[model samples]
Target: MIGIDMKLETLVNNGPAVIFLCRAETGWPVETVTANIVRFGYSPEDFISGGLRYADIIYPADLEIAVSKFSAYVEKDYRGKDPDCKVEYGEYKGEAGGHKRNAKGNLGKGRGGYDSFTQQYRFLNKSGNVLWVEAEIKVLEEEEGKACLFQVTVFDISRWKHTEKTMPSALDTENELKRIINSGHVIVFLWRAEPGWPVDFVSENISELGYTPEDFTSGSIFYTDIIHPDDLDNVRAEVSKNTEGGRDYFSKEYRILAKSGEVRYVDERTLIRRNEKGEITCYQGILLDITQRKKAEVAQRLNASRLEALVKLDQMAGASLKEITDFAREEAVRLTGSKLGYLAFMDAYESTLVMHSWSDSAMEECSIEDKQFIYPVKSMGLWGEAVRQRKPIITNDYPAPNLLKKGYPKNHVHLIRHLNIPVFDGKRIVAVAGVGNKEENYDESDVRQLTLLMQGMWQLIQRKQLEEALRTYSGELSRANEELRSVNMMKTEFVEEMRFPERAEYGEIMDYETLYAIDSQQQKAVNTFIHYSEKLRRLVDSLLYQSLEKAGKIDYSFEGMQLKDVLSDAFLNNVFLIGEKALEVEKEVPASLPEIRGDREKLTALFTALVDHAIKFTPQGGKLALEVKEGADNVHIVIADSGKGISKELIPYLFDRLYQVNDSVTRRYQGLESGLYICKNIVDAHKGEIWFESEEGLGNLMHVKLPK
Candidate 1:
């Protein structure tokens, strides 16, 4: 406020200096500039219209050197100083010209007023002219504790270049001192180190501390007179010790009593100025009001303490939910400096407030035989207010009639300062936690700590609940897997029993005609038995293959084989079935067809099963055809029959295991329903497709496409 006037527009436009304020970031994007910027042929609109940047006015060749030198000067090591103190980079005298290379081997302009300093830079103004200008830059505003805006003052120094060789006049020194002192964030003062530290010089901005410069400069009021009595002795002792120890500079934080009778925190940084004889003469220093910083520090310490307590509770990983709740309540009571704390969970189903946990330092003082912490939501007092509002409820004066007309119940503990927070699991309020009767009134910081601890405990409980659910699911899955294994074993044993001895019986029947000289009736019965026995054997094979396919244990021994060979073998083997059914067979397999990559046994079995189905379903004298064609990428085979075709609605589920359109007891198919299902599994194993197009009472065409 000292350097920034309410009439800043008028002051900057009329004064010799051109002032600009901009964001403290790369390129120093200009927010506003005085109209006097037009003197350099750049309108204020040029800077404010987002067309030009403050850094653009800096001579391109020297911008990097200027920024690099300022960066080093501003970041000069001040490790022993207070960490919260802002650094002051006053005018530097050392050489500031050198080529500073960036990663791209080019000059780079460093960003922000964090590295801001005063210096002379060459400016490339409009109209093709170069000018010498002195710039004083200071960070004047902050956002969220970060430097955000910079106030830069640029004055034409071309005229001063001629008289620069001469020493400055007293008036020049005084004016320069005034300008620098008023522009800074700190209030500058020079105090003699004798007789209560009489002030020799005080800047006009001393009014910021509710004191006038005249009052100090007149020597009627000593600097120590404004010091808070509690901090006066310690401050005097620290200064005396530093002076005797020959330490030229020292910083200390203390309190001051303002004229309005308010206490303000301040950080004082002093430089011990000495005479030629090496004897201390006076102290020159700056005083910065740091009340907000001190408050922040205290809050930060409280947060750290709260976080430590929460982390300790979290580390109790195996602790029961009740134990965690108890600990959280106790911690809340301790952290908020409350005499008692309690957590009440909202039992939604019962419409009741259930006291899950509580901690009281004065439990023995209660007169009631048993504590009554649970009540219906409608019957609760102040604790229910948090639930009703779905937010926190806080008050230092607790017994106000408007707030609690019912007051405390019989034998309830005395309540004064109180804070209650609604605990949330997602958007719903799950619980209400409250602390009561702290010696000091509860602040927002206390409320925040209590809320954090409660939320953390609830999260731990939720996580444990999820873990329990996961464990239960895992157990159920293990049982289901065991049951599946038992069923698979039963299927395997059943197929084994059905497969053996039947093959031997069929082999014995193959020689029935040679062994027994029998009549036509006996021979026909023997052949019929052989045909039905063979159908039964194919059914058993289908069941075994279906079970294996479902269990993911079906095996395929694959090789590159000729489809023609597989088809020819299948036809020769199943031609007897056609003869038995009195059906005509027409086979058109290409002689030079592209070989399909598949399991030879499975392919042979697949074609044989299709022909067998045709033999069973077709009436006597019905015709069956097997045709194979070669395509560019795959081999297509069609098995057609002039038999009673399948229903259109049943085609979709034709390959489903054990599925049949006619599932009644009177259904007439001889074998089990897994034949087409097994064929589909075999083709799928070979990465092929099997499907059919059919119409009821019309012929059916089954198509198989296998990759070549």
Candidate 2:
């Protein structure tokens, strides 16, 4: 019996399966495994010593599924048995003890049982390599009626799985190839190397070109019949050159005529099939429809050409109307594949046409003794029909009888085909442009090109005309302005001279006061006269200063001066007004004020004007304040007044020349509206900034900052 057991162990070890016996436990801990486990890069001792369990070798992705199936089998088959019963293996039963199962549940078939089950899953070897395996598990029971062990046999099936994936059936391969071919735009062809390249076989997708494969295969049509006549010679030459050069393949692009009479572009790739004798036998090739791609290319080229022409017209900025029309007419001729062209401008009433320009070709070919430049629209020929009909007119057959045709001059150039379009400015037709003698025929494309070019030309002409008129008007305006300035200068000089006479009268009054003692009424009248004369003199002086400044004739004497000293001079100049107003004035000036580079007289005048303005606006007993501050780069002065402040809406225009808050004749103000304007000019001349802040019914604050 010992010798028989040794032989059985040897037989099992030499087989292709690995056997495992594990205690029925949570982790299914291995108690024994066949020595053949070494085939999976593992030693039997590794499992028997409890270092690795049978569940541990199962791939992580398949472990959950394998354990679930094992539990389900036990629950369904051994449900009524004792929980601690040891179910031991009895005999090798062929698939009757349990159902066959796999990790994917693809093999869940066979009769139900309580002792054994079979499954297939993936296992991880020692080196982490995945192995496809088939496992058969049996429940073993002990003599004490308890399930105590699990007997598992594993067989490697990795080679068989690999074969099933890499090799597919012939029918599947053929069907897949056919599906790809039918789903795309390529048409396959096989042709005999004979005259006209007779078609031997063609793909069913030839229907895309409005033809069937049977048409060519049945010899009812040859491949060469579908190629465009204009492109066939070139295609043949290319193929012949490649074949003579011993080339195996070649590609060519040409136009083909579809059965629906539409021209379609195709790109062909052909392979030459030859016999051992170096003679051509057949040709295998593919044809791809490229009609949309070809049309896009043509449209792109046309757009580029149109843009270039428009740019050229735009660059002729100062050209005359005739030069622009002549160049544009020639471009129309070139763009539309015509031999001669002409442009004519219409009058405002649309009653007459004035011929403006003709292409160089037209001018060179015509030998008419009298070429009319202007013609009445009431008695014109075919070209005038575009203007009369208010639309384009195309005559592809020029000699055909038509009611619009009129007799031409004896020596005029002959015409074959003609296209005419009206150029519209808004809803009115401004011009009519015509092109004639195209080689093929005039169509809508020619009409489009001619219309766009003429429209661009007319715009340039109008722009040049407008520019010329502007130049002439500008010259007249400049002359008028100079004359006005001369008259203004004379008036300013006359006002300046009046100041002398006014001073003489004031002196006369003063002399009489010292010489004689007058009555009280007389004294009062004399005082009133003196006051009115003084105000008149000041008004004259302000007018004179403003005129000189505007004419750019005022000279400034810039020198170093103390800001405080300038302020003191301004206060003294306005002492009388401040006294009359009874205004309380507060001044804050730094003891060590920095000197500033400025015009002293102008700066003093600037401050005097501001002080006088504040006095006029303030009530009889209002308050005024002046503060000077020293800054890092400038000296800032603030002059504030508690007066009836300026309205918010009127503040923006306060400093404008000749602008006043109260300008009506009945208003109380008694001076020209030039005080603040003059003050701003004076400050700006000294490189200083002046701005004001005020709110209605509140007070006003004026800030001045000068560079130190």
Candidate 3:
């Protein structure tokens, strides 16, 4: 009453219900409770203080049941059996899983989606007395995929319950009349059976239709005047029968015009009231509002249309982003009844706008030069306002000077009623969509439909991006796999070369050495030739063995073999060299070391390499020790020697192929520096490790671990 600014708040506060908003977590703590809470004999401060919670006021016996039901309801799983609360008979026809037409006939989607539910519970009030209250709750906010707040409207229903219990059986008709007259859902009236059907009495709830009972009784307005003109004849004819005694009662559904110029549907029931003389005196009637039910039917038709459009969009899978954007533009124009629509893409920082797609009824085209000037934010227009404010902008008078500070280009079409909505990627407005020149003013419903269509298109774009990435990764993986296969094939060829043919060649060289020995004149050159040929043969054998190990082509068999036996055999194989050097050999080989699953041939070769390396580097009479021990899951073998140990600078590269620590001209070794590298490969093939620690002048300790 004070000003239009406060009118809405005043009206809601004076309304017949208490409205509240609260957190969605356990116990539903109150965030804001409206002034109307005083109707329940409690101050709004009490709830807002945070000391009291919604669950605390609920009757103790019903608290648990209420919390459970509320949770299920908010989660969209509580399909109650009450006829009025269940999904309507035919509403679920083609709905999807986790989604159904709710009681209000709206298609409910994910958890805590659009839904309405009615609940009745007892509340303990400030007066220390219990009151029966009926509450209507709806999900008001959902954040991070969880319900975060709810809007609740509550009303005291104690009087209605009390009336039902005390009414007598014999006076049922009188009680029924009184109940109907006082009911909030209906308006009861008594009208004199006259020309205008003047009201003699009317229910207090006639004000709900935006008119007072006093207005009808003051003679300035009559009951017939409020009836919609289209429905006046039907209503008059139905009521005449009851008044004229053609029938004692009559019922009809008709439209009524309210004081605010809004048409509402109502079902009317009338009965003629007469004295014992058998003449009609007045008409007794009740009008129940059915406007909400009628509106739901209209919404059902709209939803069906929206569903068809959604299916058509979904069928465009694998479409390019531009194609999807174009389709969305067309749909936006069609649904909102706009004459033209355009999509503008924003740069990463939202600093630039580029017109990406256009749907124009005028079939207008922009020259390449003119397109550059289109809707730049710095120009300061409706389109620019959307980017600057990061919100939607709608203007019926789009051509107004103040709204469009920088006017449109000469070639641009005239915009008479415009709507612009920002398209968001998370919190950033990645694009702005504009539609213009609708015959009627654009409303919130138009914006909602267009925004939903855009969201679906965004999902399609994201899917396309993910699929492209997967294809790229798959191609890279395939190329890498092919390269590995090529390397394995080359190894196979080398392994074949090292087979019977190469060994036979070595045997022929030995035969030549024998021939040279028999010829005494050439005996001097025999040692040199033998040394060169044998070293060449060893190089070829090491290369072939290491290659086979790398390609996983080493055909070694696994069996339970003792570590001590393997080491003993390796030591025995090297007995001649050890005896020639007169090395101090110490054996700590356990007689019964743990048996490991390994290839006997490969294990023997691995230890042989270690022992050979030690003897080659050790000076004569140097100490050599072989030790074997059992471990948690492996057999440990240590071969140590006091040799002219490797230099610190060269130790890291000892296991590298063709890497010689000493100069080739003055080297003491007979073969290439691939021995240690070959040794490492052999150990690795058996799933074992080989490494050595050495000091330049002291000794070297080589450790081997073979898993059991």
Candidate 4:
């Protein structure tokens, strides 16, 4: 490059050198400049004398054409000609030889290659021989400052040109290979036979595989050392299957454990063969990844499982109610690995889920309507949205950020995942189920499971509710019959008692106290039997009247009622046992617990049962306290006692019929276990919940949360 630039300067400074431009059209310089030609040589001079007409000069033969092109460009205006024009130049071999040097050759001590100050066109002289010389010129500049012609400064460039032919060194070749491999191709490896057979190095471009020659020192290395354990078996099996007489040509998938312990799976293609001497020769291969392919397979399975779940939901249509409900949850949990689940059916009023269940050790017996375990539909929550839209929804984690930002409680965050699904009976959502805390959180599996769960629930809940209604009615009748029989026996026995004579010494201790004990025993039997009958009779009456009123056959509203007046009637109906147990009562009504729409007979049955329960459980000296508190649209009625407190376990099942304490002989309470169940049934019928808190030896506090 230095020689070329210096040569340009030399041409410009040389004394009077002829210079001309080559033109494609006219083919010669009209006027030209020159100096002596002897030094530069006529051969090279004649090469530049004419301009291009294309046969050859520097092109090896057409010397006169180059001269013609130069003279034509010098004379033409070229003002509006094409901006892109071609220029041709030439210099002869003999004249150029003076400036040439061997770049790869040793020079004399303290000496460096000389620079060329000039170069010219290579052309054939008048003698028809190639020659070289210098030339220079400048073109006129336009007002726009664009040059119409190029300035030409020519000198011999043969010496510099000679250096371009020398071969590149070994270092250059290695660097070139490095560049190629860095572009991301090239596989390298080493293998041995019998764990040590002078390492056979393999590389697509072996010399560029990057290890220096010193790396091969000592003994050959075993390739098996780099195979990851999990992939080693594959590698070995593949190699063995294709190997015979210590030779194999095979392909297999295996993982290579890099120095950093990252195992990269690779598809290795090998080429192996034995030499004629029966000696093993080569094990070679290329490696590629197939991880994405594996992921695609998993995705395919997930899609199939999802489709299967959808089909099952359709097949089970109109199936047994219990079977369908059960199948729904089974498939749901299986799909999502959900630890807890529920399915609920909303009541006609669309106010609540009348039937519900979930999977929770802490709440096995709790209802979906229970506040501690289920979301409420009217509560402006995920549950509300699920039902309102009649769709399936999933919450990967609870204490939902958007819901929380909109005012949900933070305690729910610990609940992990949550899902809410609606079951549409028709145009409206009549059922719902919220499965929570998915083992794998919400994913395609979960969405699929929930879809089927909801679909199944929608079909069964609609008809199942009708079946439950008939069962409830049948149970009510059986209870009524039993109570009526006991009531008749009591009436007969009371009359029989009236006719009995006081014997001389049936009990020598014939005093008022003793007399009271006898009367207590008899009164208990009479009161219990009578009270039970009356309550059952009233329940039957309510059921009958409500049915009629619902069908528009009766007017159910009362004339007017006072809260205390209603309670007093309820208290009177159960007073028969009050005297028998000798229990003391405390009543406090502050007007907060308002009287609301309800049947007098139903409240009577509710009150009578509660009072009966208090008396049966109280110790002789204990008392039952009845209290009330008012809220805006509802009331709270509390019945508390100083009796032995209920066990934590028993309290939860208090309202379940036939649930009696097996240790009753030790605890010593009277009455069948159905008393609380009756009380709970009445309260529930009135849109209320009977809640209680108790601990052994501390006493019990019962709360009847009633909606006004």
Give Cα-based local distance difference scores for all models.
0.72, 0.75, 0.70, 0.52
- TM-scores of the candidates in the order shown: 0.33, 0.37, 0.31, 0.31
lDDT of 1 at 67: 56
Please write out the lDDT profile of model 1 over residues 382-406, one tens digit for every residue.
6677877778888887866655435
Instruction: Assess candidate 4 and give its TM-score to the true structure.
Output: 0.31
In terms of TM-score, which candidate is strongest? 2
Number of clashes recorded per candidate: 0, 12, 0, 43
Q: Which stretches of model 2 miss by more than 4 angstroms?
A: 1-237, 256-264, 282-289, 336-340, 361-375, 394-402, 407-418, 436-449, 475-708
Candidate 3, residue 313: CA error in Å?
0.5
Question: Higher-lDDT candidate among 2 and 4?
Answer: 2
**lDDT per residue (tens digit) for residues 40-63 in model 3:** 678888889987888888889878
Better of 3 and 4 by lDDT: 3
For model 1 the TM-score comes to 0.33
Candidate 3 residue-wise lDDT at 167 = 55
Residue range with the least summed lDDT across 10 consecutive positions in model 1: 78-87
lDDT of 4: 0.52
**Candidate 1 clashing pairs, residues 3+ apart or interchain:** none
Give candidate 3's error at residue 217 in angstroms.
Answer: 5.2
Model 4 lDDT tens row, 242-289:
664232456777666544444455667765645655455656555555
Residue runs of model 4 more than 4 Å from their true location after superposition: 1-223, 226-231, 245-281, 284-582, 590-592, 595-617, 620-622, 632-634, 646-698, 704-708
